[model samples]
Target: MSTTDCIITSSVVPDELRLNVLPCYLGRHYLTGESMVYDWAARLCSSYEGGHWNFFTLSNGGFYMAPSNMDRVHVRWYMNGYSDMMGADAFGITVTLFALCHLAEHTLDDVIVTRYHQLREFAVHHAEAANILRAID
Candidate 1:
């Protein structure tokens, strides 16, 4: 599957904010993947134009899709994990955080768990804090 396959990105404010808010696109969209990266820790995001979907590695662990399209698009994502529908940006962040939390819980790895907490701490200040909390909760 590709990243940002079904997502869009608008103008980034300062370009340095941890959770730079971006506009969302419309419709039910998604990036499709076979099995290239459903188990790895993380990978550097690449340009979708370059044939690779943008997947970003979080500081804690695991990865999330970054909006590669410059035009803001609206996408209603159905998070199968929790049956929750969310916007593109919120979906990416929440799913990434969810993976970290699940990894920590299942593996019981001190390091992974710590990373989950670290990201969770930072997420509280994110623009999509409420959405992230709902998914993670």
Candidate 2:
């Protein structure tokens, strides 16, 4: 699929107010120590009915999503900064995924979750990252 299509499909959800939809860009910013990102995400979540959206902070960043089923998630990314000496830079992207199960489980709930669980059976697995991504995706 095209990149835009993939992103939209992953982030799209029913027009309900119970699901959590956190874009990847917001999540990354929150993880990278941007305080304003969290505030914006919180405000966006609060705008929904029934307090559907909620903000979550992971070790690496923050994300916004609905707390129940029937909610949608949207994310976008942008360039933040880069390193001149190391030729490195910081960038971001928004990501969305099915989150029906996360609302009730306090964990991931989708195809990604299954894949992560399988990956975890092996040694040297990033359980924490996997957990966060699983929910975000």
The per-model lDDT (C-alpha) reads 0.41, 0.28
- Candidate 1 positional error at 81, Å: 11
Worst 10 residues of 1 by lDDT: 23-32
Candidate 1 lands at a TM-score of 0.44
Residue-wise C-alpha lDDT for candidate 1, range 1-137, written one tens digit per residue? 54323232223234354332211110111111112222221321221132223454443332344444433223222442433344545544554555555555655656555545655655666676676676566
- Runs of candidate 1 with Cα error greater than 4 angstroms are 1-85
- Residue 77 in candidate 1 has what lDDT? 28
Per residue, candidate 2 scores C-alpha lDDT tens digits across 1-137 of 64223221113245653133333332322233233333333332333233333333222222323244323433221232211110000001111222222222433334334422322222112223333343233
